[model samples]
Target: MTPTQIGLVGLVALFVLLALRMPVGLTMMGVGLVGFAALSGWGPALAILGREPFVIASNYELIVIPLFVLMGNFATVSGMSRDLYGAAYAWFGHWRGGLASATITACAGFAALSGSSVAAAVTMGRVALPEMRRYQYDPRLATGCIAAGGTLGILIPPSTGFVLYAILTEESIGRLFLAGVVPGLLLTALFIVAIYLQTRLYPELGPAGAPTPWRDRLRVTGQASSMIGIVVLTIGGIYAGLFTPTEAAGIGAFLAFCLAVARGRLAWSGISSLMLRSIRTTGFVFLILIGAHIFNPFMARTHIPSDLAELLVGLDLPRLAVLGIVLAAYMILGTFLEGFAMLVLTLPIVHPLILALDFDPVWFGVVMVIVLEMGLISPPVGVNVFVVKGIAEDVPMRQIFAGILPFWLAMAVGLLLLIAFPGIALFLPNTMIR
Candidate 1:
């Protein structure tokens, strides 16, 4: 069979495995290993397996992944999320849909510290969901806000997704992290606006809660200073070249631990649990990385990415049309695939195709992230939505999905903004790095 045909068959098998609910890492590795052995002799495939593990593990850039994950886990156990949400609620509690807006704000802030969407969603769901429910906030809005807002964890700095994208595409991790800032903030703003607009159009959707006393609000603000300090020290330190991304992560983890202890939130038992969870999460991530190392080279051997690039260029389609097609594919795959799976599966092919077309890599990364963010909230297997659903199980799944529609629309708007003004993504990275 032609290499193209072989690649197609491999992809179909991969999808079939995924349909059977196999782990994504295993699916990619399984398909790639079998296909590589079929394409080349068994010797070359065996040789790849022998060498690739060391290569993947030795990659200096990859260290950032576990460091960031560890930092997030540390922040979660430290009880920082509660203080951040309290501050947000105090400031915004009086406005209609204020609790929902506050939830988004708090999620964004917590994301700055946590950088894992699942962590952010699960953490904030614990902190914010009950409060909103207590205030009789709209179930749809309350749950949707947490789900949608948690996505910011990936787009904002310290993002595990950004780190993976950087390592895969060979882009500078620092610049990609910086590029995400404006887009992340814009999406956060868009989410906030959507919440307000929803409440305005249907006041019944979010009844105003009791106003927070000014004195109490000031006190909450004081409690949030630790979070502010950590954000500045970590993100600011990275941007200013005071520390590498990994160093910043380590510093953030240390500070979070200290703060947790200072606040008396962490017991010896809690520390042990946090360490175990972080190690387990890190192990899962490393396994996926190893799988990607094995899988990516096999796809490369097929010449599929180059062929697709040539085919697209030969068609003479408008750049926008090609981009639309790519984005549409992400949306579909995202319904069933997790973000990391989507990136690993596609980047091996897509990155080369995108580079061949002469699109800016940084801009393309931002666009890809936005598309993946949509997948996080998209139905059937939206991870963030499920995280929220798990939190608010009393609320029907359909209602939560319904609540997410406007936020999805807001995300569409954010995507358009990035597409129209690539500078929104490029400007910060260019100014900071160059």
Candidate 2:
């Protein structure tokens, strides 16, 4: 059979395996290896299996993934997330829907440190949910804020989503990180507005907490300062060309470790467990990267990307129209597929079309990460929803989903604004000190 036909069959088989609950990394590797062997030979296929893992594992750029992840893990144990939530609560907790606004604010702050939606959601849920419950906030608004706000983890600077996208597209990680700054802040503001409007429309949804005294607000703000400081030093240092993304990550990790130790939270046993979790997360991400490496070459050999790129260009559609179509596909796939899975699967095809359409890679990375964040809260496979549900066991799963709708629409508005003003994503990257 033709290489293209074989590639198509392999793609179909990969999806079937994924549907059967096989791991994404394994499914991609299996399909890629077999497809390559069919089109080339067993020797070349096996050679890839031998070589790609080491190449991906040792990739210097990828070191940022684990370092940032460890920083997040350490930060979690340091009680930084709680401090951030406390600071937000001190400032915003007195407003209508204030706790929910504080949850979004805290999530955005923690997102800078965590680089993980699940971690942000789980961490903030633990810290914020009980407080919201104490104030008798509507369960829907409380759960929704946690789930939706968690998504900021992947859109803010130091984002895992942008990191992976940069690696996949061979773009500058620093540029992509900077590109996300404005859009991330924009979305955070949008979420806050969504909560405010919802509370206004339905007064019972979010009742205000007791107002904080100036001294208490200042104290909590000081408590959370180190976490925010670290984020600026790491992400800002990259933009200033003071450090590479990897070095920034290392520095962030070291600072988080020091903070945790200083806080007396880094017990020997806890440190060991945190390290192991970091290692596992690092390993999982590396496996997906390796699998994508294998699958990418196989797809290249099949000319699938080229064929699709040519087809899109030939259609002569408006550039924005083509871009919209690609994003829509991502949205649809995100409902069922995990973000990383969608990234590795679609980027090979989508990146080429993006370049062909003359879109900025960094801008597209921001846009893509936003869409992935939506998937994290989108129904059916909404990973963030489940994470929040795990925390609020008394709250039904459907309520969490329903709660997210307003925030989900908020995200959609954010996406449109980013598209309408691409500079929102590009401004920081373009004006980088470097």
Best by lDDT: 2
Query: Per-residue lDDT for 7-76 in model 2, tens only?
Result: 8998899889999989889889999999999999999999999999989987889999999999999999
TM-score of each: 0.97, 0.99
Q: Show the lowest summed lDDT stretch of 10 residues, model 2.
A: 155-164
Candidate 1 per-residue C-alpha lDDT over 88-179 given as tens digits, one digit per residue, 9 for 90 to 100: 88988889999998999999998888778888899999999889888888899989999999999889988888887887888888888888
Candidate with top TM-score is 2
Model 1, position 24, has a per-residue lDDT of 78
Whole-model Cα lDDT per candidate? 0.87, 0.92
Which pairs clash (backbone N, Cα, C closer than 3 Å) in model 1? none
